[model samples]
Structure formats: C-alpha cells, structure tokens
Target: MKKIAVILSGSGVFDGAEIHESVLALHAVEKAGATWHCFAPNVEQLHVVNHLTGEATEESRNVLVEAARIARGIIEDVAKLNVDDFDALLVPGGFGAAKNLTDFAINGAECSINADVAAACRAFKDAKKPAGYLCIAPVIIPMVYPESVKGTIGNDDGTAAGFNGLGGQHVDCPVDDIVFDEENNVLSTPAYMLANSISGAASGIEKLVTKLVALA
Candidate 1:
C-alpha cells in the first residue's frame, strides 16, 4: 500500500470554505485505496467567531501544543516510520494555514521556517513520488519545489494573475476538469469558484487520484 501524509491547518473551526476541499481530498484518497496519515498544526485554542453576532467561541481545551510541536510530530511520524513508507505528501487548503505562513510557516510569517516539511517535500520530489494539492494548497508546491511544472484549472481569470506571479501556468477551464503537467502531477483547482460544484470537483479529484496512483 502506498502511504500518504495528509497535511491540514489545525484550525478546529470549520469554515465552509476550508472544510470542503479537505473533505473532498480525503474522500478521493480513500476511494483510490491508498493509505494516509493526517497531520495538523497544534494550537492551544481554536476560536470561532460568529460573523453576524460577533460572539467569540473556542474549542474544547486539551493539552496545549504549539505549531512547531505539531509539525515536529509530523516529521517524527514520517521519520520513525520511514519516509519510503509513504508515497507522497498531501496538503489541503484552508484559511488559517495560508494566513499565518507564506508556505506553511507559523507566527505571522516571522517564525523560523519549518525546514523539516520542506525537506520532506523535496524528498518526495526527488523520489518521484506523486504529490497532491488542491486550491491554495498548490501555493506550497512552488515554495518546496520551485522547479516542478504546474498547471491550474478552472475559471481563475482574476485570480490567475496572482498564480502567474508564482510562475504557474494557469489554464482557463472549468474546475470540474482535471489539469495536469506532462508528468501527470496534480495541480490547482478553481476552488475559489467551484465550492458548490461538488460533483465536478469530485470528478477532477478522481482523475488526479488515478494519475497519482499510477505514478506510485
């Protein structure tokens, strides 16, 4: 079985935007019959504020852990178990993860870079293991493997400008279609617009998953 590490932002608050892609990715991986491990940044508290009422809420308290701790746990789990044990790294898109880090960093972007995560990603690339990213998750790819080719699918006309800045080739298409490079690496989606098109996104995800499993 090919093992994959699924990375997620530790924000317990389930914003409609964040949960959709993550859940979809999870579903796709499972449907493909691949093994996966879940990873999340740790926070002492996760707050959820009501948009209308402005009331602040927090998740249940537990032993407080910092982002570094959680990231370390990911590394430890990967290492102790062996990197070759896993076939690839999977990152899910969410606001909290994107906000705090340029590419999975913590502490308002000023924190020490998590070289471990970067190293793991590099290892995957060097090994030719298939990597998967959805939505904003692709933002982490350029940071980790700048030389890798990438393609974006869906109507990101306005957002495509920003992606071009990252040196990614943006293809104008519906998010439902799968976009890929010649090597068949999975790429970005029109996640910003395709939130309601669950069926479309699922089809795209299925295509990506099929390609990735073939690589493995």
Candidate 2:
C-alpha cells in the first residue's frame, strides 16, 4: 500500500488546519487504497484564535498537540518524518498552515517555513516524489521547490500575487479543480479557498488525492 504523509497545522480552520479539508483528504487517501500518517511541527502556534468569534486570543498552544485533536491522537512530530517511509505527501490547508507551518499568513512573500516542515517537504521534492498542497498550503510550494513552480489558491488575487512574489507561477483554479505542476511533481487544489460547501471542496480534493496516489 502507498503510504501518504500528511502535515497538518492545527485542529481548527481559524488558527490551525481546516478540519474539513484535513478529514476529507484523509478519507480520500484511504479510499484510494493509501494509508496516511499525520505529522505537525512541535512548536507554539503564532497565535490562538477564537474560532467562534473569529478573534485572536491570548493563549499558547502546541501545534502538534492541537493537531492531534484532528488526527485522533495518531500523529507525530514533523521532525520525525522520514521521506523514505512515504510514497507521497499531502498538506491540507487552514490558517494553521500559514500561521504554523510557514509564516505566510503574516509575512506573505517573505515568509519563512518551520525548519522541520521545510526539511520534510524538501525531502520529497529532492527524492522526486509526488506531493499535494491544498488551499493556502500551496504557499509552501514555492518555498520548497524551485522558482516558477505552478500552484494555486483558488484565484484569490492577493494570495496569488504573494505566491508569485515568492517565485511561484500562480494559476487560477476553481473549487472543483486542481493545478498540477507536472514538472515539479507537485499538485495543488483550492479546497475551502473557493468551496462554499463540503461537497464542493471534496470535488477537487478527491481529484487531487486520486491523482496524487496514482502519481505515487
């Protein structure tokens, strides 16, 4: 069986991994006959957000601990992820991706990715393995691959610009579609970036997972 490594940011959409996207991607992986292993950086979140009110709160939380909430406790520190053990990589989007995986949410084009996250992702690229990024998580693609790697964030002009600024070739993709950088062996989709509903997001996510597993 193909083993896919999933890097989640946190447990919520506002400050962590988008739960829906994460769950949907995992389900799709399993349905594709692929097994998934979840990982997260062992660091503090940039800031906590009250998902209820969409406001920042004064609290501290470990990225891995919060991410475990979504993983149902079956997760590990990203630093322990060995690219050789996995066939492909998948990173589901949520504010936690930008906030914890990389500082794209705050620094945009100038963001710096967490060391372990960068190492794990770049390991896949260096090994020529296929990988997929969903929603805002594509922001990490440019930071991982070479210049002009094609990616998408569901046609958000500002985010697209940031992606381009970071040396990526941003493509306008819809909620039910994906942008594949065949040359780089990378894939991206606009999950919640354009989806107004779960089924809408699943359309592209399912396609992405199917293609991702096939590529693996």
lDDT of each: 0.53, 0.97
Candidate 2: tens digits of C-alpha lDDT, residues 48-117: 9998899999999999999999999999999999999999999999999999999999999999999999
So what's the TM-score on candidate 1? 0.69
RMSD of 1: 5.5
lDDT of candidate 1 over 70-159, digit per residue (tens): 334433322233457788767655543444223322332222323444566667767777777666555555555554356553564644
Q: Which ranges in model 1 have alpha carbons more than 4 Å from their true place?
A: 11-17, 42-82, 100-114, 183-186
Least accurate 10 contiguous residues by lDDT in model 1: 104-113
Best by lDDT: 2
Q: How high is the lDDT of residue 179 in model 2?
A: 95
Every model's Cα RMSD, please? 5.5, 0.5
